[model samples]
Each structure stands twice: as structure tokens, then as C-alpha cells.
Target: PAGAGQDQTFRADDEPEHGDLIVTEAGVLKVLHTPGHASNHLCFLLVDQQLLFSGDHIMQGSTVVINPPDGDMKAYIESLYELLAESVRYIAPAHGFLMGHPEAVIDFLITHRLSREHKVARALGALTPVDLKALTAKAYDDVPAAIHGLAARSALAHLLKLEAEHRAFREGDLWHAIHES
Candidate 1:
């Protein structure tokens, strides 16, 4: 039922960009361009209530996947940091129930991603010149084997972020970590 309406073509009357305000009967919703989950991801903030309508930017119980070529780990993390400047008290995620303690949630997400990145770097360092599959296995050993395929996608996102920072490099399909001398 997820793609049930894929065959239908729908058009929007008005395309709302980042920073656009949508005033509804409930309150004024400010559009926040929070990329990284997908390049065009947007989160709406209810100005009066300090509640964020987080659409895939933040999840309630589970972390969202960061599949690359569309998902950028660096951008996702940066977007999370940007939310800290906002006066968000509640998050109404696309999936699951509304969440409270917005700042703490954002902090935890950032810390968790950074910790995962560190694990990725360590795994890459230990298994240099390795393929994504191998690197993911080493880095995400705690993750169940059934979901390694999904984990590899997030691992690739991490590797891309590391590569952007010059902390890692890729040759063909293999990834190599850059060590400081």
C-alpha cells in the first residue's frame, strides 16, 4: 500500500520553498528545508506551539535509512544541528507518535550518528581497500545480518561523508581510510 498512488499524477497549486510560511486555521507553519534524508526534504514548524512536523527528518522509535545518491550523511547531520537553533518542543514525525524534549532528541540523534561514523572510520581503518559489504560488516556488526543490505547503504553514506572530509578515499569499488602520519 506504500506506493498505491504511484500511478496517479497529482499537481500542487503552490510550491512552497524553504522559509515559506503557511498559515492554517490551526497555526502558522514555517517550512524548514531540512535536507539529507532526501535532498528536498522539508519540515514544517508550528510557530505558535513550538512543534515541528518532522517528515522523515526525525523518527520516533527507529532511525531512518541514509541511502546515498539522494541521502547525504553530512547534510543530514548538519540539518539536525540547524534544528537546535529553533524553538522546537515537540516533533510530529512522519512515522509514529509525537515526541517531546526536542533538543534532547536532536542531541541524541547527532551523537548516535557521530558514534556510528566513528565506528565506520575504525572499521575502514582496520579493513582498508575493502568493499562496501566488508566495511559494513565490520562497522555494523551489532546490526542483524538480515539487514546488512540496508546497513550498507548508510555505511556508504558515512564513507561518502568521510571522503568529503578527506578522512577516507575510494578506488573503484573499494574504500580506503586516510591515516595521519
Candidate 2:
């Protein structure tokens, strides 16, 4: 995504936040603040057609790369579930064609992410205090080596999520699994 230029500054009043109902001639475009793909990612819902303009939140037949800091596994999954609860018939992604099964897609994405998270946990449970690269190699062996660099970052995101839940701990760059007695 390209950064807005200096001239494209937006005022607070004009800014659309989460759950803001915006009325237009076409229809009401409900603003849903779906962060995690990026910190400020959003998806607009067309009230009339029940169409969702999913801007990079969910993609067509591809998993979103959950990079750390800006991209969060937890937040991304939450956003997916939130969108699942909504009445979306069609999904118009930023890339690719429109998707008819929005709910199934959203649910599948959630399941996929959770499954990856589980694999990360299992990998951690197998080893004691491991670096992100080793965990990624073990957990995401299904992924190609060329993209392991990217997968490492996504693994780090999972570790961070595990740490947030107190299921794991970080000691410097090495992460340790935290097993509750």
C-alpha cells in the first residue's frame, strides 16, 4: 500500500471509524475497522446488495501473510470472526474476482490460521527454547523453503500470540514454551 502524500491529509471529523454508518446515493456503506493485515485495514459493506468490499483483509484462495507488529494473528482471526457474524452475501476483494461464499471463506480462513497456530504450538512443545527459523522449518514444512523467510515472520507472529496468551515466553530472540501445571 502506498503512503498518502503530504497534500492528502485527512481531518478527524471527516475520518470514518469502525461501525460508522455512511449514507450515500448508492447505498449505506458500513465501515468495519478490520486491522491485522495492516494496522488500519478496513472493509466496506454495501447495505443494499449485501456486498463486502474486502480491501486486502481476506483474499481469494490464498492465506494472508500475517507479519508481526503491523500484522497480528490474533487480531486477524478476530476480524475474520467479526466479519463472519455480519450479513455478507458477496465479497469483492482488493485483488481477484468477487467471492460468493463469504461466510465459508471467512470461516475457512479462521480455521486455517488457528491450525497454523496449533502447529506452531506443537513445534514449540517439541523443543525447548527455539529460534523462530527452527520453529518455522518444523511447523511449516508444508510451505516451500523459498517462502520460509516470509513464513518465519508469520511464525514469529504466532509466537507473539502465544506469548500474549502466556502459553509461551521469549528470552531474547529464542522463545520458550510455557506449560501450565
Using Cα atoms with residue i matched to residue i, what is each candidate's TM-score against the true structure? 0.93, 0.92
Off by over 4 Å in 2: 1-13
Candidate 2 lDDT tens digits, 1-181: 4346644565456778999999999899999999888888889999889999998998887878788788888888889989988899999998888999887888888888889999999999897689888999999999899999999989998998898899999988888999889
**CA error at residue 41 for candidate 1, angstroms:** 0.5
Lowest summed lDDT across 10 adjacent residues in model 1 is found at 1-10
Local lDDT at 30 for model 1:
96
lDDT of 1 at 172: 99
What candidate 1 gets wrong by more than 4 Å, as runs, is: 1-11
What are the root-mean-square deviations of the candidates from the true structure over C-alphas? Answer: 2.3, 2.4
- C-alpha displacement of 35 in model 2, angstroms? 1.2
TM-score of 1: 0.93
Pairs that collide in candidate 2 are: none
lDDT (Cα, tens digit) per residue for candidate 1, span 55-172: 9999999898888888999999999999999999899999999999999999999999999999999999999989999999999999999999999999999999999999999999
lDDT against the true structure, per candidate, is 0.94, 0.89
Candidate maximizing TM-score: 1
Deviation in angstroms for 16 in model 1? Answer: 1.4
